[model samples]
Target chain A: MEFSSKLLQNAVHEMSQLPGIGKRTALRLVLHLLKQPEERTEHLSNALVKLKSEVNFCKKCHNISDTELCEICASTKRDGTVVCVVEDIRDVMAIENTSQYNGLYHVLGGKISPMEGVGPQDLNITSLVQRVKEGTIKELIFALSSTMEGDTTNFYIYRQLEGTEVATSTIARGISVGDELEYADEVTLGRSILNRVPFESSIKAT
Target chain B: MEFSSKLLQNAVHEMSQLPGIGKRTALRLVLHLLKQPEERTEHLSNALVKLKSEVNFCKKCHNISDTELCEICASTKRDGTVVCVVEDIRDVMAIENTSQYNGLYHVLGGKISPMEGVGPQDLNITSLVQRVKEGTIKELIFALSSTMEGDTTNFYIYRQLEGTEVATSTIARGISVGDELEYADEVTLGRSILNRVPFESSIKAT
Candidate 1:
């Protein structure tokens, strides 16, 4: 698509570089910005620049933060001894929304996907190992997705903790509470049955 | 949703202010930028700032342009006497892409919509009238959308040109090419029937 102004074209070109945004969408967004007051565009640009220049990662957990440590990592209330490993900050937000886990997070940044050239070293695995070796963590919970890359990353981290005394566990895989048992995939259904909790324990939660 | 960083949260808030973008999508886009090299974010920020601060509109046609007059308006080959009135620059690009019309364009910037508090005074309608009053323009084609607002804007302009010697006409409304007659909307089908052209003239075009 041809643009009437070079500046408009450049803005759209940069916008379309983002994931899932195409040129047409970029043009629409740029045109929308053009229609609005200049202050809106200034705000957006200022925010992006400030975010890039000022944002930092938590030194302990690798989560996005404004300071040396993320809130969760620095929180006295959260259980630092139980680190829940996740793919990214979004997972941290999702898990935090549930309010079920009181443990601190260890953001891996991403899963180890060989096809995507994302290896164990490319993630925050080394720091995670160091955290485990510090002997403060009692249990490490694997909270990544149930994909092959997730499993591979989990196994890699588990191997790294071979000599450490930290106990390792994974979030349970099962049918959703409101979902029908028959509709559950075979792998999830089979695992739920094989790892079934005691009847009394399940009854107590409900 | 809670954010680990205030800077990240602020960025997401500002990004979400854009049309069609929400907080969740804003967070995703911000995180994606965070994952990329810092230069990518800087480039995006710089482009938006430059576009907003430096972009200019064609003085004659009101199309977004780098100079006083747009390329089409300055072009000697384009028929200056035949002016096509459009809602915005996007319509100009759409018509240009068709490669059918050789006329210059007068971008009204927007249609008159009372619901949105937009009136003819808010648009480039006055400049259009001035262009017609110059007596250089022999024909004015209303190429706005087929919506109620588009029709109202068109009629308003037509009234402004009531005493002018320039001929006025609207772009045709008919069943689109390759469209099935049975599936066509009633208004468009009815208009096509009422404004049917000579059979020989239609045959000659094909």
Candidate 2:
């Protein structure tokens, strides 16, 4: 779409570079910014610049941090011995919200997806394996989504830990707690049945 | 949700302040930027900052422009005697895309809405009135949306121009060109019937 102002065009062009935003949405957002107080735009610009320039990845786990080491990796309260693996910081935030897992996280950044030209080497797998071989961690939990890429990455990492004594396990897949069994996809329902636990084991979880 | 990094949290907060964006979507957008080259984030930040600081409004039409007058107002080919009053620059661009309206535009910045605490004084209506009183514009067309706020703004402007010699009209409201009568909304279909023009006039619009 044509823009009346070159500045507006440039701003929309840059905003539309984002994954899901289209040109029309970008124009709407830029125009919205123009309508708001000038300080709002300044704040957004400053926050992004500051994040890009100063944001750091954890030296130990690869999660984004303000300092050299992320908070989780630096904390003594969290269990560093059991690192829950995830795709990115969003997953880290999601798992953190549940408050169920007290263990630390190892952010792989992304799963291996051949379709997207991302391989094991493109992720943070090397650092993860190195951390595992350094020998303090006792258990590693694969908490990535249950997509094909997730399974592939899990298998690749498991094979890499062949000689190491670290026990690796994946997060369970089942129908949501409040969802009906009939509404569950066939594959998930079948897997839930095959992976059913003893009655007392299910009771222990609560 | 808790964030491991303060910088990430700050960026997400500012990003989510935009209309239609939520915390979850903001997090996803921010993380996407983090995964890309650092220059991508820098470009986006710089573009927004530049637009906020340097963007200018045309002195005549109030449409966004790089110079004193907008391209439409400055052009001799455009019919300066017939000015279209619109809600904002988005409407200007939409009408420009049609290539049907050759007149200049006067953007009102926003429509009058009591629910949003907006009024005529908050818009560019005063400048528009001053322009009409100058007597160069022979006709004024109201092209705002068909919302209650749009109609209120249009009527408010019409009242302001009551003593002026300029003939005033509104953009037509009717079913879309390809829309079937049965599928059209009752109000629009009714308006189309009530405002029916000569058959030759309808053929000329095509």
Model 2 CAPRI quality: high
Q: Which ten residues in a row are the worst by lDDT in model 1 chain A?
A: A66-75
lDDT of each: 0.91, 0.92
Candidates in order, TM-scores: namely: 0.95, 0.97
Candidate 1: list runs displaced more than 4 Å: A180-184, B203-206
Which lDDT tens digits does candidate 1 get at residues B58-170?
Answer: 99999999988889999999998999999988899999999989999999989999999999899999999999999999999999999999989999999988889999988
Give RMSD to native, each candidate: 1.8, 1.4
Q: What would the per-residue lDDT of candidate 2 be over residues B156-206, giving only the tens digit for each residue?
A: 999999889999999999999898999999999999999989999889888
Per-residue alpha-carbon lDDT of candidate 2 for residues A66-153, written as tens digits (9 for 90 to 100): 8898888888899878999999888888888887899988989899999999999899999999999999999999999889999999
The weakest ten consecutive residues by lDDT in model 2 chain B span B30-39
The residue ranges of model 2 lying beyond 4 angstroms of the native Cα positions read none
Estimate, for each residue in A1-206, the C-alpha lDDT of model 1 and write its tens digit. 88888998899999999887899888889889888999998888888888888889999999998879878888899887899999999999999998888999899999999899998889999999999898899999999999999999999999989999999999999888999997899999999999999999999978
